[model samples]
Target: MSQMITIELNGQQQPLPPGSTVNDLLAIVGSDGKSVAVLVNDRIIRPESRALHQLQEGNRVELLIFAGGG
Candidate 1:
């Protein structure tokens, strides 16, 4: 079995598999992938690199969502 790691998600601590990537985090957060932005330890993550970004222990992650308004 893989070790589970804890990360802060939207201010709450969440447990994830050791090998989890940004893409996996997106899935956990129920992101539709259209109007969302991701940041890890204050670094902006491009959409194309989300899959390649590997999360580490005690990494600070922030997720932003853009909503359409008139």
Candidate 2:
């Protein structure tokens, strides 16, 4: 079994499996990752890097989603 790690997701505590990447978190959150900006420790994570960027314990993550309205 994989150990879980806690991270701050938009100011709340989010538990994720160890070795989870940005893309993994997106999937877990039911997000398709489109029109969403992800930041880790105040650093912007590019879309191409999301799959390779690994999240660590106690990391601060902020997710901003863009919406279109007529």
Candidate 3:
């Protein structure tokens, strides 16, 4: 089994396996992949960072959703 870490997502605690990418979490949470911003450890993660980013233990992740306006 792969290593795992616990993180907080949208105020909830969840366990994520090591080596998991941002895209993985989005899928796990059923994110639509649009109008959403991801912040890891108080830093905004760009699209390029998704594949390169790795979740660490005690890390805090915030997923913010933005609404479309006219």
Candidate 4:
């Protein structure tokens, strides 16, 4: 069984399974990151790297969702 770890996501503490990638995080939050920008621990994560971006414990993540209105 995978151990659940706590990480800071968007200023809130969230529990996720170990070895969860950025992609996995997005899925859990119900956002695909397609129209959103992510800042992980004060670092910008590119879309291509999301799948491989391993989230560590105590990491601070921020999701910037872009909304369009005309």
Q: Which candidate number has the best lDDT?
A: 2
lDDT of 3 by residue, 1-70 (tens): 9767888887889898887788788878888467579999889988777877887777789988867778
Specify the highest-TM-score model's number.
Answer: 2
Query: Model 2: per-residue lDDT, tens digit, 1-70?
Result: 9789999999999999999999999999887646789999999999999999999999999999867778
- Ten-residue stretch with the least lDDT total in model 3: 27-36
lDDT of 3: 0.83
| Model 1 worst lDDT run, 10 consecutive residues | 28-37
Q: Answer with 2 or 4, whichever has the higher lDDT.
A: 2
Q: CA lDDT of each candidate? A: 0.84, 0.93, 0.83, 0.90
Go through the candidates in order and give the clash count of each. Answer: 0, 0, 0, 0
Clashing pairs in 1: none
Clashing pairs in 2: none
> What is the lDDT for 51 in model 2?
93
Error of 3 at 69 (Å): 8.5
Assess the local accuracy of residue 57 in candidate 4 as a C-alpha lDDT between 0 and 100: 89
What would you estimate as the lDDT of candidate 4? 0.90
